[model samples]
Target: MEETGYTVGRMRPEWGKGGAQSLTFVVTEDCNLRCKYCYVTHKSKGKVLNLETAKKFIDYLLTSPDIHQSDSAVLDFIGGEPLLEAKLIEDICDYFKIRAYEEGSRWYWKYRINISTNGVNYDSDEVQHLIQKNSGKISIGITIDGTKEKHDLQRVFPDGSGSYDTIHKNLKLWMSQFDASTKVTFASEDLKYLKESILHLWDEGIYNVSANVVYENVWREGDDKIFEEQLKELADYIVEHDLYNKEYCTLFLDHIGAPYEKEDFNNTSCGAGKMLAISPDGNIYPCMRYYDYSLNHQPGYIIGNLEDGIDFDKARVFLLAMYKYQCDDECLSCPIAKGCEFCQGFSYDESDSGTNFQKAKYICKMHKARVRANNYYFAKLYHKTGIKRQNFHWKKELLFVLDDQYASFCSYHNEKISDQRMDIELVKEGLKFAEENFMKPVFLHSEQIADEYLTDYEEVEVLHRIPIQAYREDLPFYDYQIIVDDTSIDLLDKIPFQSNIIFNLSYENISKLSDMMEVVWRKTDRINLNLSNLSKTSDLSEYQRQLEKCAYKINEIEKHTGMLKELNVLTDIMFIKEHEGCPAGEDSVTLASDGHFYVCPAFYSNHLPSIGDLKTGIKIPNEELYRKDHMPLCEKCTSYQCENCKFINKRCTNEVNVSPAFQCKKAQIEEKTAMKLQKLLEGRYEFTNIISAKEFEDPIDMVLDGKMMRGYF
Candidate 1:
C-alpha cells in the first residue's frame, strides 16, 4: 500500500534528478579535532575501513541485482573526518570504478562520490591529491557553522578552543576549487547568531546555505521564540538586500508551511532504510545514524555483514517499511506535518521502547517556529514583488496583457503598472506563438493601443477588449468589447445596442452595485465582479443576505419587465452545469508585454516566474500540481463554482494544489448559496446538474477526517 506521486515536501532539496541509489561507506571513526556538537561519540583511531574490505563491498554492490537496478549511484563517504583517511577513500573510489567497468555495471558511467567533512584537513596535500584524482565524480560539502563567534560557540576543539581560524583559512581554498554549499547547524546557545552567520556565509561568496536547528530535546523553554525572532530578522535582511534569488537558506524555502497531501501519507522524513550504509568493520546499517558511534543507547542496527549477504527480512520489514503512520497519532494527523523532519536513527535512539517506528517529536515546536517565519518571509516577498493572492478568473481564453491599463483591469489592483505602450511587433510575436500553439487570443488594452496595434496583426484573428474609465460613443464599434467600471455603468444607456460589454463591479460601491447590476443585465449579460478584496473576517451572513437580495432583485426585474435576459451569480451557475473554474495553466495562459507566457495575467502583473518564454515555448515546473486530480482538497470539493485559483492557493497556503482557509470558506458559502438559488429557480430552468449541499464547511476538514475519498467528483 505504498503511495506514489507526492513530493518529499520541501525540507530536502530535490537533487540528483536521475534518482541515484545511495551507498555510504563509513571510512573511519577517527578525526583531527573533537568538536563539541560532534555526533560520533566513539571516535577511535583503531577503526579504519581497510582497502580489501572496501573492495569486497564494491564487488558485492556491482554484482548484486538490486544494486544494478538503479540507473545511477552515489558512493557516499562519511567519518569523524572523512578527509582524515583521504588516501583510503581515493583507493576505494578507484577500485570501485575499475570493478564496475570490468563487470559492465550501469554505475560505472553514472555515479557520484559525495563526502561531508569538518574542513580541518581540507587544505592538506593528501586530500587535495584525492580530490584532483577524482575530479568530475566528487562533491564535497564542508561544515562551517557561520561566523567566527557562532562557530566557536558550538564547534570547538577538545582543548575548549575555537577551530574557526583553521576552517576559515581553508574555506578560501575550498571555495576556489568548488562552488559547493556549506552546512550550518543552530543550537540553543548559538540561536542569536543565526542571522549574522548566514549573512557572513553570503559575504564569503557561499550563497547557497543549508542551515537547520538540531532535532534534539536540548532546546530550552523560550528557545523557540528566539529562533523565530532570528529567522524573522534574517528574512527582513534577505528581503531588504533583494538577494532571494541570488541567495538561498533552506529554512526560507518557498514550499514550506503547507498542508500534506494524501499521497504524502506514509512518507519517511529522510532516505534512511532505502539507502545503504556500511561500517568500518564491514557490518551494514540503514544509514550513518545507525552506526554505533552516532547512537547513544543501543549497538548498531546491523542488517548483515560483508561475510554474508544482506538480510532481506531485517532490511525490509524493520527498515524499508518505515513510514509516517509509525509515528504518534498527533503527528499522523498534524495539519502542518508535511515538512516536519525527523531522523530514523535518532528516533530509534530516543524511543522509550527502543523502537524506531515511534518517531521522536523533539523538533515539533522548532519546526512550527520555522513555518511561521517562512510564512512571514514569503508574505513579505510576495507583497514587495506585487504578487496578488486572489483567484485569477480568466476563462479558457488567452489574455494578452497589452499595457498598464489592461493589466490594471485584470489584476487585483495591488500595484499599478507604469503607462508604457507595448511594441506592436511584440504583440505580433505573441500572437504568432499563440496561433502556432493553437490558443485563442484575447487582448486587454486601452483604446489607442488597440487602434494602433489591432491592424498590425491582420493575419491572426484576435479578440480585443478596451478598458475605459468613461463611455465614448464616437469610438469605432467593429467587433471590439469594452470593460466598463462600476461607476460608469450609467453610461450603458449611451452605448450601442447589443454591444458586448463587460461590467466590472468594484464592491466598494456596494449600495450602487444592485442598481448597476440591473443596468448591466438590461444592457448585456456579460458581468464580472472583482470579489478578490472580500475579507475572510467579513460578515458572512450580511454578505449572503446581500447576494440573496441581488439575486431576488434581478429575478423580480426579469419577471416583471418580461426581459428574456437575466444574469447574476445564481443564474450563472444554473446555465453552466459542469465545473467551470479557472484553469490557469491548463486552459489558458497570459502573454505579457515582456513576451513571456505566464499562468495568468495576475502572475505577469505580480512579477511571478513565467511558465515559459517565446523561445522555450511552455515548460511549467511541477505542472501536475495545477491539475484537479492532484489537488487533494479541490478534488473532493462539491463547490463546482469555486474559482480554484492557484495564485491565491500558493499565496495563503504555500502550495498551488491546496486551497486556503479564506478561499475554502468563500467557496463553501458560494456553493451553499448556489444550492439555495437552485431551489428558488426550480421550474424556470431545466438544470442538468443539481447543486448538492455538503455537511462540512471546509473541504480540508472532510479530507483530514477521512469522510470523503479523493476524486469525489
Candidate 2:
C-alpha cells in the first residue's frame, strides 16, 4: 500500500492556540431503537451525563484563558438520542443564560447550543419549552431518512415497529415552533428507495437535505450507474425549483467555477486537533465519532477525563498523527483531492488488525465516482446557463510578439532556418485576423523596416531589436519596444525612459546581465527579463542564483531610489493570479512567415506542424493537445501558478501535454521563492492579493513511481 517515492505522513491543520471553539457532549449512550448502521456498540448501556458532570465541562471551558477569549462558543449534544435527557439540556441552557446576564451583555450573546436528535421526543412538553426558551441561541438538527416506507425499513423501535410516524410528527412541530436546522440522512443500496426518499423530502419542503453512501457496505453491480442517474435527476430538480438561488439549500454548488489553491489540494480533513468531544462518563476524545466508538480509554484515543483536564501532550500526539496521515497514491494524485471527504475516523474504522493503508483502496472507487458526479453536476448547470469556466480565455492584457525572418532562426540550429520571413501579403492577412480577433499584436523585426509597411498599421506597435553596435540615432520610432541582449546592456542608458524594453538573457550570458543590474535599474522602470535557452538539462541552481541576485538588486534600487524595480519572475507570480498557463492557439494563433498558422511562435521555432494556412483559417488538428484539460498530469496538479509552457513540455518530453520533471520542479521552486519574497515586501508594496503559495510535493513522482512517464493514456 506504500506509494513509491512519497513519504507517508499526516498533515497538521492550522488552528488557533485555544484549540476547537466547538465542543460536543455525548450526553447519553441509552437508546430507544435499533438502527442497522449504528456505529455505537454499547447503546443499551444506559450511561448518561448528569447536571454536575455537564457543569464541570462548561466551567473547564470558560476558565481556560485561550478557549474563553472568543466571544462565541458551540455546545453540541450528541447521543443515542440527546433528547432522552431533556432536563439536563434545559439546566445547562439556564446556567449559561444566568452566566451571561451576570457577567455582561456580550458574555453569552454569541454562544450557541445545538443538539442532533432522532426526533422521537420532540412533541414532549419539556423539549418544547427548551426550544421556546432559547429561540435564536439554541438550534436543533433533526435527522429524517426521508419517506415513512424507506425510513421505517432501517430505523425502527426497540420492539421492531416503525418509528417514522412519531419522528415525522415531531419534525413538523419542531419546524413550526422554531426555524430549526433539519436534514435527511439516508443510506441504502436500493436505488428506488434512495431516489424516492430525496424526492419525498423535497416535496415536504425539506430542501436542506444531505445523504451518504454506506462505506462499510459493498456496492454491487449497477449501483454506481443508479447513483449517477439519481445525481443527474437531483441536479435537474434543483435547477427546476430554482433551489440554487436559495441560501439554505445546503447542497454546496459554489465550487463550480472556483479554482483550487495549493493549500486546498494538499491537506487533511480531520478536525481531531482542533475539536474535543466528551463522553457521558466525562472522558474526552477528539470528536463525537471517536467518542461514540467507546474507545476513550484506549491508548492514543482518549485525551483525558473531566477531572484531570485535557491531556495537551496526548492531544498533540493525536493531532500530529491525523495531520501526517496520507492516503494511497491514487488519492494523492486525484484531481478532486481538495474536495475529498476521507478522514482519520474512516481510516481507523476501516483499517485491518495489522495494516494502515488497506482501507483507502476499499473507498477509492466511491470517492472517485462521487468526485466525477460532482464535476458533472456543476458542468451541466454551467452549460444550461451558458456560463463559461474561469481562466478559459486567453489573457487580454498580454501582447503577442510575432518575430519575423531574421529573429526566427534558432541560435543552436545555425544551419537550419527555424522560421522564415512572412510575405507582406501574409503579414497583412495576419494583421487582419488579429484586428478581427481583438488581439494586441506587436510585430518583432531584427532587420530594417520600410515606411510603407509601417503606414498601413499605425495602431500596431512594432518592437525593433537593436544590435549592440547600432548607434542610438539609428533607433526606430520613439514609442516602440526596444529588444536588447547582454551585449546591449551598456546602451540601456541611451534608450528612451518611457520606452518599454525587454532584456533577453541566454544561458551563456546570464552572468553578464546580472553584472549590469544596477545600470539596467537606473535606466528605466519598464523592463522585462526574458530567460531563454531553457531545456531539461538547464542549470536550475544557476538560474535561481541569478534570480536571487536580481531580487536583491531590485530591493537595493527600491531602497535608494524610493521606486520599486519589478523583477518579472518574482512580481509576475504575485499578480497573474490564476493559472493562465500558455495560451497557444486559443486566443492568439501565430501565422508563421511561411504562410501557415502554428499554435504560437514557439511551435514554428520548434519546427512543429502548422495548425492551418491563412487561406484555410486556423483549424487545430488535435486541439486537445494544446489544452490544459488534455494534460492529465497538469490538470490534477496543484501547481496552478506554473507557467505551463507548451514549448517547454514538447521540447523536453516530445509531447505537448506531457510535462518534464525539470519544468515542474522549476515552476514549483519559483512559486515557493516568490511567496517568500512576497512576505518580505508585504507592507512595502500594495500587491494585489492574487496568488497564494504553499509547499508542494510533485504528486506524479510521489504516487506514480515514475510510471507516468509511460503516458497518462
Candidate 3:
C-alpha cells in the first residue's frame, strides 16, 4: 500500500495562487436526500452526465490549448450528491488519466480528482472502491455541517428524518483513509449552531473545516450580531484549548477583519470565470454556480458547449467584465472591504435587471460581523504572544541640483535654461542646510563627478544620477538612485543598482513609455511619471490609456513572475489613503548653483522667484499657500499619491496652492488607473488600505459645479 500522500492531521487548500485549471462534472442531478440550504433548486435522475458526454468533454478539455495552458488540472465532481454516480465518476477519472498520458499532456501526472459529496452514499462499497483505486490522485470531501443536532437541522431526508446518523457512522472510516476536510455552510436558521458545530468537527478529527455564511439576501436584521458572537465563542474555545494552530476555520483568519489597501481587496470572491463546469446536457458554464440548477431566477449562463468549444465573449464577460457589475461605488470604496466575499453567479441571478454585472450584496452585514470577530481573535492572539504590528514612517528629503545640464525633466524641474554648475563649496553648504533643517540631502547631477568630489560631500544621502548609462563601478557612491529619461530608456541595462532606479518620463513621451513598459519592470521599481508641460494639446484620454497600460503591466509581472515591483505613478495612489502629496516648501527646499534657495529645483531651473539665498536663512513670503489646506480643490481631493507639483500649479493656475485643470485631470487619471490596478492585483498580495475609486473625474470640475466648497481664493 502506498502512503496516499495525505497528511493525517492537517489539510489546507491553496487559495488564490492561480495555477491549476478546474473542470467540474455535474455527475448526476439525482440524490438520496434534499438538504434545505442546498443551492441546487432542481434535482432529477433524468439529468445525468452519461459516459459519452463525460468522455467528449474530457477529450475536449485535455486537447484544448487554452485549457492545457495551466500547469495542473482539477477535475471537480459535484451534484445534488456526486456519490450517486460513483461508477460514472470512476470511469471519467480513468479516461481522463489515460487520455492525458496518451496526449503527453503535463496534466498526466499533475491532476486531482476532487469529488464533493453529501456523505449519505459516502460509505457505499462502490465509492470506497473508487477512492482506493485513485487514492493517490483523488480528494473526496464529505459535507458534514458538525454536531448531529446542527447537521440534522437542515440536512434531512424526504421523509423529514435526519441523515446525521448515517453520516456519523462513516466519519471514523473517512478520516482513516484521507486527510479529511469538510464544507460547513450557515444560513440564518442555523446561526446558533455555528460555534459548537465547528468545535464538534474538530473533536471528530476533522481539523480542517472550510466554512462560510450564506451569500444570499436571506440574512435577517440582527443575524450579524449572532454570527459575530458565535465566532467569538469559537475563538475563545480554540484559544482555551490551545488549538489555534492545530484547528482550521475560515472565519477566524488573521488576514481578515482589518481594512486592506484598496488595490489588495479581491475583485470577485469565487473562481467563477476561471473554473469550468459541464452540465449533464453538455452545456458549459464558468462555474457550477452559473448553471441553471444553482441559480434562482436567471437562466444558466453558458460560456461553451461540447460541439462549439468556448464562447470567448461569454467567458470574457465572466472573467473581465463581471467585476464591474459585482461592485458599486460604496462597496469598492469601503474601508474594510479586503476580505469581503461576493459570488458573481449569485449576483447575476439576483440582479433586478437582466444584467450580469450588478453585484448582490446580501452578505455585506455578515462579512462585517466576520471582520469584527477576526479582529478580536488576532488581538487576543497577539496579546498572548506579545507581538506588535509594524508602523510606516514617511521621511522628507531635499534635492540639490548639481548643475543645469542634469536639470532637464527632473521629477520637479520642467526645463533647464541655465547650465551653471554648483561648485564643491556650494554642495557642502546645501548639505549643511539640509542637516540643520532635519531633511535628508539628495544630489541630482547630469554628468558623473570625480570620485574625490563625491567623497567631499558624504552628507549627500542619495545621488539621483540622470541617464542610466552614466553609472560606473569605481564611483564612490554605493547606495545612490538612477533616473532614466527617454534618451536613456534603452540604456536601462547599464544600471548597476537594481533597487532604486526611477524612470522619469514626461507627458510628451507617453506613447514611448507604453511601448517600453514590458521591459522597464525588469530594471527599476519606481517611475516618476508626470507631465512636465501640461499644454492645451494634451489629450487627457490618451494619457489615461497609457497610464492604465503601465498599471496593467505592473499587475502582469506580479501575476506571471510573482515578483512585485512598484510603479510610482499608479501604485503610489493605491497605497495612499490621505492627501500626502508633494512636500516642497514644508519639508524640502532646493539649492541652485547661484547659491539661492527655492521651493524646489523646478523653481530655480525655470528662473522663478527664489524664496531666499544661501547667505540668509530660507524664507518664503507666504508659506501657508504651499500647503494643501490653502488649495480648496486639492484639500477636498483624495488622490494622495500624486506629487501635486507646486511648480506646475504656479505655472498653470498662477497660484502655488491651486491646481490647474491639467494637474487635476492627470491626478484623476492616475487615481482611477490605480483602482483598476488594485482590481488586477487583488489576490496576489494582501494590502491593508485602499486607493478608493473617486466619484468625480476632476476635482476642479467638482468645485466649478458647486459640488465642493472653494479653497483659498
Candidate 4:
C-alpha cells in the first residue's frame, strides 16, 4: 500500500530479509473427517507446522517493518481442521498480540489473519473473542457444499456417514458466536449443489460469503459450463439480495469478471510468479498451487526465507520464468494474443517437459472457446461493425482454398515419434517417397521473418540457394508445392457445384467451447503489468524449441500448400527430397520463429519418417487417412472452422486418421446441429443441399447421408 504514484510496495517483497510476512500455520493436520476429493492423502501423514514453526514465522513477519506500516503481513492458519488445534491457534494469536505491545508497533505487523476450517467442529469462545479483539480483521472461511446428502457424499467422517448437518450446525453456532461475517464456501461435484448450498447458507442468515470452485485432484476448475452457470447464478442472486456490495469475493468471477474496483481496470491475465505462492513444504511455486508434488521445488525458491536467509532477487527470477514459457511461435501472431500466459514450474512437477503441453492444449481449447465467446460478444456489441470478415462462402478465393488446405494439414512439427529417435534412413525414405510419388508446383508465402540473426544466412540464401517465400512478402514460405488451387479458377462455376450448406460452424457458438462461457471484465491491481506483460516471460529452453518446430510446420503448409496439391498429393507428402528444388531434407527449411530445421514437428522434432529414406514416395502407414478418405468425422461432420488433425492419430493415438474424443464429441455436435442452423441460414438466403435434415452420430454417418459422394466419399 504505497503512496499514490509510488506503488513499488516496500522495495518488493523479499524472502529471508522480510521475516515470514506470509505465514501459513497448519495446526495438527490430523482430522476427524476425510474428503474423498482431498488432494493430500487421507489419514494425514505430513507433520503439522507445530507451535515452533508458528513462532519463528511470526518473528519473520515482524521483520517486514516497512510493509507493516502500510499493511500487516498475512497469517493464514490452515489445517485438516484449524479447530482441531484450536488452542495452538489461540496461543499463536496471543503470542503476536503480546509481542506487538512489547515491541510496540512491530508486533501488530500482520495486516490480515485468515483461518480455513471445516465447520464440523464449533469454534472455541476464546478464538471468537480473539477475532473480535482484532477488530473484524479475522474472518473465518468455512466449507459447506449443499444439502446434507451431496455434502456427505463428497466428504465424510471415517465412518463414511454424511457430515453436512454437523458442519452446518457448527457453522450456525460459529456465526452466532462471532458477530463478524463468516465466509461460507462450497466444494461440490455438481455445481447445482453449490447453488443449493449457498441458498441454504443465506436461509440460515449467514449472508456474507465467498465461494471458490474446487478443482479435482488435478488443479482445474473442472467443467466450465456447469461452473460458469452456477457461479453467475450465485452472482446474480447476491446482487438481487443486495449482498453484492459486501466484502465477499469469488476468484472464479474475478477470473472471468471481477468487480470494477478501479478506473484503470482492464483484462487480467494469469500472473504466475508475480502473485506467487510459498508452500508449507517450504518450496516456492506460482499462484494458487500450494499443494502438488513437483519435487524440483526447493527451499531456496522461497520468495523470502522465514528465517531471514532467503533472497528476493532469485524469487524475482522465478517470477520472470513463469509467464514467459518459451514455447511455440503462436504467442506473437495468434489472434488470441492476450490469452498466452502459462506456468512452466508447475509443469516441471507434473509433466515430462517443464512446460505442460497437455495443459497448453487445454488452454488452447479454452482460448479458442474464449475467442468464440468474444466473437459473439463482439458481434452483439459491434453488430454494425461492417468490416467484412473472411467470407467463407462458396466463392473460390485461391488463397482461401490454399488456406483451407493449410488449416486442414495437421502440422506434425513437434510430436515425439515412438522409439525411432535418430532414424536417418527413415528421414531419407520419407523425403524421397514424398517427392517422387507426390510432387507438385505451388506458390508459397515468402514473407521475411523478423529477428536480426538472419543476417548470416542472407548471402547464401539469396545468391545460390532457393528462395524461401515464393514471391509474397506477407507469407513466410514461397514456391514449394501446388500450382492449381492457387490459380485463377472461375468462382461462379465453382459456386454452382459447391455445397452452400450451413456447415456445423454456423451453429458452433461459444457454448460449444467448454472453457469460456461468460465474461467478468474485472480489473486487477497492478504490480508492474504493462512493463512486464505475460508475453516476454519464460526460461523453458526445451518447449521453446518444440514450439518453434510446430510453428515451422504450420508455416510450411501455409506457404507451400498450393504446390503440394498440384501433384494430387496432400500437403505432407511422406517424401520429397528427390526433387532438385523441393526443400525437405536435414535442414532444408528452418522454422520461421526459431531458426531450426528438422523433420515434421508432429513426430515432435524427430522429423517424420524421412522422405529420402523411404521405399516409396508414399511411405506413411495410412496415407489415405491423411486425406478426406480416412477422416471419419471431417468427411460428414461439417465443422468448417474445426481443425481436423491427421497428426491427432500419430501424436495422441499413433493412428494417422484416428479421431480423439475431443474431435468426435465436438465435431459431431456441430454437424448434428446444422439442421437447426439451416432454419436460421434459410432466412438470410436461398439454400441448397447443405441443409439436409439427417441425424449424424459421427462424421461417417454424414457420409451415409450423401453430403458429397463424388470425389470425397
Candidate 5:
C-alpha cells in the first residue's frame, strides 16, 4: 500500500500574494565552462530557451494577474553562462521594453528585469548597446566565487584555465554601466565570508549584493557530519563576530533584531505557486528552481506556440505536497517551533526523497545542543507569561523531559538520508553567495563603531504549551510518557534505557506509570473533546460553572489536553483564551496531531496531567536530551511561556533535568514564530496582553518576575 502517512491538515496561504521579486530566464544550456555540480540533467541536454518562447513567457508574465501584485519583478537571465546566449536575452529584454509601454497598466506594474552571467563573453559592444538601451528595466546578477584559487576550483573554461580576470573585467564593465538601484547580488556556496565578499565587490566599484547558499543534494546525501559541522562553524562564526549585525540591508539580520512590535509578520507560510516564473521558452513555473514543464525535455528550439503547454496550478499542488511530509519529528511539537528549517531543504538527500541523512546523523551528534535550545525556549515561556510549573522533573540523579512523542523526534533529529519526497527545484544562485560571504574579511576588525552598536541584544524564545483534546485509545502514543512513581523512576533508573530495555518497558510501563502519575486524556474518559466544542462552557451545563469558576478552567472539564493545532499555540490552554496571542491563521491549528493531547508537560493549570509515553514507539534514542533543567537556557530564561519545554520534558533532560542544545534552537524558533504571528495579526486586533522576547532575562527569572512586562492593561 502506498502510504500517504496520516492526513496532516490543509494549508491556507494568505491570499493576493504570488511570485518572487526575481525570475531567471535560461538563455542556453550550452556552456563555455563546465562545473561538475551543475544540474545532473543539464549535462546531456544541449537545449536553450529560444527567443520567441522567451517573449511569450514574458508576455504571459506581464499580463499575469498573479504576477503583477508583487512590489517589483526582476528578470534574471541565466544559462549554462547567460552570456553564451546573450543575444537571445537582449532580444527578450528589448522586446519587453518596447512593448512594455504598449501594453496596459498590467504590463508596467513596476516590473524591473535582470540577468545572471558568468562574465564569459561579456565584453561585446553590440551586447553592451542592447543592455544600455534597456538598462533601466534590467540589472544583472553575477557569479564570482572568492579569489583565483577558489574560483578556479570549480568555475573554469572548456580547457580549464581560470577565467577570473575576464569575469572581474566584465564585472567592472557592468558596474560602470549601471547605477545602484539595479539590484546587484553576489552569490556563493554558503553564508561564510559575506563581509569579505561584499568588500571584494566594492573594491571593484560595485555596490548592492544578494547572497545565497548553494542547494545541491541535486538531491544527494552522506555528508551529514561535514555539512553539520560546516553550518555549525558558520553559526559559531556568526555568534563570534556578531556578523549578523542589525543592518537594514541584511533581511535576516533585520528580522533577527526586529522590535517585538515590528517582528510580527502575520502570515507564517510563503505563497508557493502563486508568484509565477517564466522561462526563456515561455513556460511558466512557480519559481526558477523548477524545470520548465514546457521545455525541460525539448529536443529542439521551441517558439511562439509555447503558451499551450504550461499548467501553473498543478505544479503548485506538487510543491505544496512536499511540506506535508515534513515536521512530523520532534521539533514541531517542541514549545519552540519556528527557528528550524521545518523541512529537508537545508540538507540534501540520498535520492529525490526529501530525507536529511545529515539531519539524522548531525542531529544525533548535536541534538542535545538543540534540546538545550528547546529548554532555553521553554524557559522563556515563563519569562514571557510568568506562570510557573515543573517542566523538567528532577529526581536525585535523573532529569526527565516528560513527553510521549519525543522518541520519534529524537530518531528523526539525525538528519537521515531517506528516499521520502524531495524538492526537485534548484536554487540557481548558489556559488555567488558563498564567494561573497565565505571569503575572509581583513578590515572588519579595524573598523570603528559606536559603543551602542556593540551593545548586546539578548535573544528570546516563544514558548507554547499545547493541550491534546481528542480521544483515541486505538492509537494512544501522541507524546505519551509513562509517568512512573518515585519507586518506578528509581526502578526504571536501573534498566539502562537501551532499545531492549525500552522494548521491555513499553508494554507494562503505561499501566504501571499510570498508577504513579495522571495522564491527560485516556479513552476511558467520556468528556474527552475535539475541535468543534473547545470552550468548556460549550460543553454540557454541568461543565459551564466549573469552566467559569477556576483561575484557568474552561468549563466542567477542569483539566484538558487539547491538541495544539497549527492555528493556535497551546492544546490545553489553562491561563485564559483571551491570553493566548491569537490563532496563527486557521490552518495553523490543524498542524497539531489529533487524538488526546495536553497543554505541554508543565501541568501548571491544565486539566490533563500529561500525554503518551516514550516506551510505546517513539524514536528517541538518547532520552536525556530533552529536559529543561538539563539545559543551560532554562536557568537563563524566566519567561513562563518561553520555558515550557516540551521536547525537553518529553525526552532529553529527563535523566538529569539539564538542557541539551535542541532547547536553544527551539526557543529561537518559537520566538520567531510568535514574532511572525504578531506581525501578521497586529493591525487586525487590539489585544491587551502580549510579551516580546526581549523583555525577559531567562526562564527562571520570568517565573520570579511574574508576567507583567510591557505592562499589559
Candidate 6:
C-alpha cells in the first residue's frame, strides 16, 4: 500500500502577491564567438529582435497587473551576446525613459534595464551611450572567464582567433563609462587557475564578481580533487585579506555564510513560473533557459505568444508540475532539500515530449558537493573565530539544580545526593565560572525559588517541576518553565494556555497520551514533546509507529476543527530551521546536583562521567566529540533535523558522535513522511520542502558499482 503519510496541516503554496515583476528579452541568437560548452544549438542563426518586436514585448509585460501596480520592474536583455544589438537596446531604453517623463503616469515606473553580454561589443559607441545616458537605471554584466589565458581557452572567435585582448580592453572601457552596479560573470573548468582568475579580476579593480563551474560538462575524479584544493586556497586567501567581512567578496563569502531561502522549496525551479522570457521570435517561455531554439516551438516549453499574451491554462500546468516535480525519494528526504534547485528545462529531452528525470542526478551531485564545501568552510571558520553559523552555536546555558525533591528526578542523582542540602560554596564558585565563560545559569527546583542565591543574578530561568495535583500558588519570581509528564495530561486543562511547558513522554507511552491531546491542545498549541530515557534496549520501531498514529489522530482533529496543530515529533525534521544537530556540550554544560559538571542533563541523569566539578571549574575532556562536524556520517548526511544527542549516541552505540542505526532509520522515516505529506498538500499549503527523500549517493559510487560488477568491490 502506498502511504500518503499524515499531514500536519494543509501544505499550501505561497503564490506570491502581484504579477510578473521581471522579464528577460532574448534580443538575439547571433554571436561572434563559438564557446566550446555553449548549450545553444542555433547560435549562428543570427535571429535578432527588431525595435517593433521589443515594443511588443514591453507592451505584453506592462499588461500584467503586478507590473502595473509595482513601483519598478526589471528588464533583462540576454544573449547570444545581447551587446550585438546595442542600438536596439538603446532604443528600448529611450522608449521607456520617454514614457516615464512624457506621460503623466508612472507606467514606466522606475524601470531598470539589465544587459548581460560578452565584452566583445562593450567598447562600441552605441553601447557606451546607453550606459552613460541611463547610468543608474541600467546595469551591465560582462562575461570574462578569468585572466587572459583562461578567457581565451574556450571563448574564442569563429575565425579561431583569441578575443581575450579585445574583450579585456572593451571591459575596461565599459567599466569606466558605467557607474551603476557592474559585475563580471566568470566561468572556468581549469581548477588550478580558478583562484588565480578571481585574484586577477580583483587586481583589475573588478570587485563585484561571480564565477561558476561549467555545469554542462562532466567532472572527473581528478577535477574534483583539483576543485577542492582550489577552494581551500581561495578560502585561505579570503581569510588572510579579511575579505570575509567585506562586501567586495560577497560571491565567495556567500558560499561560506548562511544559506539563502529566497523561494518556497515546493516550487522546483527559481523564477521559472514567475518570470517570463520573450524570445527573439516573439514566443514567450517560462525563463530564458527554457528558450531552446529547437524546443521553444513545442507545447510544454512555450507558455504563450506575443499575439495572445500568456496562456494561463498551459502556464498553470507548467508551474504546478515544476512545484510537484521531485527527482526521486532521496531528494524528498535530504536535509538540504529546500536548497536544491530543479529545472525541467535543464533536463528537457529534444526527442521526447517531457523532461528526463535521470539527468537530474549529475546536477544533484554538484549541489550536494557545494553544500558540503560551504558547511565545511563555515565549520572551520566558526571554530577558529568562536562565531556561530546558521544552525550551529557555541554558547549555551548550564541548568543546575538547587533542589531535587521531585518524584521524577533521576534516581541516580537522588541516590548520590541523598539528604544533601544545596552546596552554597560550590554553587558560588560555579556561578563565578559561568560568568567568566559567559554561560547563563538555569536554576531548576521542585519547591520555592532560591531567592538568596539567585538575587544577584538577573539572567536566570527558573524551572519548577511539580506534581500535577499540587496546589497552585503565586507565580515564580523568574522566567518560569513547567515540566510535566503523561500523568499531568488531564491537569493541563486547569493551567493557563500561555504557560511554557515541557511534556515529558517515554517512547513506550506516546500512544497512551494520544487520548489526552485535547487537554494538551487546550493548554498550549506549541508544546515541546520530550522523549525521555531512550536507550539501546528501547523498541524505536514501536515508538515510530505510535508517533505516526498520534500524528494521524491529531491531523484528523485539525481537519475537523480547521485549526492547525504542530507536534514536534522525533520524525518531524525541519532542515532550514534546525541545520545543526544537538548542541550537547558544545553550546551547553550541565552542573548536576552532585556538584559536578557534565555535558548535559541527560549525561548527569545517565550517570555519565562528569567533565569537571565546581572547585576545579568546567573542563570538558575530548570536547571535539560533541562538535557537529566531527562525525563523517553526520557531516555528510542531509538529515540536519536530527537532535544528534550525544547521550543517546553513547547509550546506543558506546560512541558519542556515532548515531545508532535505529535512530538514523527513525529520522529517515520521519523525513520521508513529512516530504510525502508536503507533496500531497503542495498547492494548498504554504510549507517549504526543507529536505527531500530522494536518494543521492556519490556519482563515483555508481561508477564503482559498475566496476564491482566485474568483482572489484
Task: Please give, for residues 240-276, the per-residue lDDT of candidate 4 as tens digits.
Answer: 4544333233322212211122221222234444433
**Model 1 residue 225 CA deviation in Å:** 0.8
Give the lowest summed-lDDT range of ten residues in model 5. Answer: 438-447
Q: Residue-wise lDDT of candidate 3 within 1-713, one digit each (tens)?
A: 11222111123556224568898999888888888888888888789898899899988887877663578888899887889889999999999988989999888988888888878877789999999999888888889999889999999998999999999898888888888989999999999999999988988998889898888778888999999899878766665665766777777654453344435434566788788899899998988988998888998889999999998877887655434446787776554565677777888899898566787888888887876566555444433433221221113466777777663444454455555778888877776666444355667767555343555242223445555666765665454666666667777776653765566666677777666655766666555554565664678787788878777777777887887668676776666566767788876688877888889877877778888877787898799887666778877788877777787778777888887776777778888888888888887767655767677877866666663546653
Scored by lDDT, model 5 comes in at: 0.36
Top-scoring candidate (lDDT):
3
TM-score of candidate 6 versus the correct structure, residues matched by position: 0.54
Please list the residue runs of candidate 5 whose C-alpha ends up more than 4 Å from where it truly belongs after superposition.
1-24, 43-46, 59-72, 177-213, 218-272, 275-284, 292-309, 312-322, 325-713
How far off is residue 389 in model 6, in Å? 2.7
Q: What is the lDDT of candidate 6?
A: 0.58
Off by over 4 Å in 2: 1-20, 64-69, 99-107, 247-252, 256-261, 265-267, 292-300, 318-324, 352-361, 387-571, 575-685, 688-713
lDDT of every model, 2 decimals: 0.72, 0.59, 0.74, 0.38, 0.36, 0.58
* Cα RMSDs, all models: 17.6, 14.6, 16.9, 24.2, 20.7, 16.2
Model 5 lDDT tens row, 1-713: 12221100111221124343555576766777775445424532467787777777667655756444455555667666677676677777777766666865443556666666676776887667667777656666556764555566666777878777777777767667764312222223423343444445544554343432333322124333333343334333333443322111221211111111212222222332444455544555544444432223222222223446445445445343332233344433333233233212223232234332222223322222232322333222223334221323211110121222222111111122222211111011111111111111010000122122221212222211111221123321112222222222344332212111111112113233222212222222212111111121222222222222221221213224442112122112212222221111100111111222122212211233333322221223343434333344455542233333342333444532443344433333444344444444445445444535565422444444656664542
Model 3 misplaced stretches (Cα beyond 4 Å): 1-17, 65-68, 260-266, 322-325, 388-713
Q: Is candidate 3 or 4 superior in lDDT? A: 3
Model 1: CA > 4 A from native: 1-15, 66-68, 318-323, 387-713
TM-score of candidate 3 to 2 decimals = 0.58
Q: What lDDT score goes with residue 313 in model 6?
A: 75
The lDDT of model 2 is 0.59
Model 2: weakest 10-residue lDDT segment is: 1-10
Best by TM-score: 1
The TM-score values for the models, in the order shown, are: 0.58, 0.57, 0.58, 0.41, 0.44, 0.54
RMSD of 6: 16.2
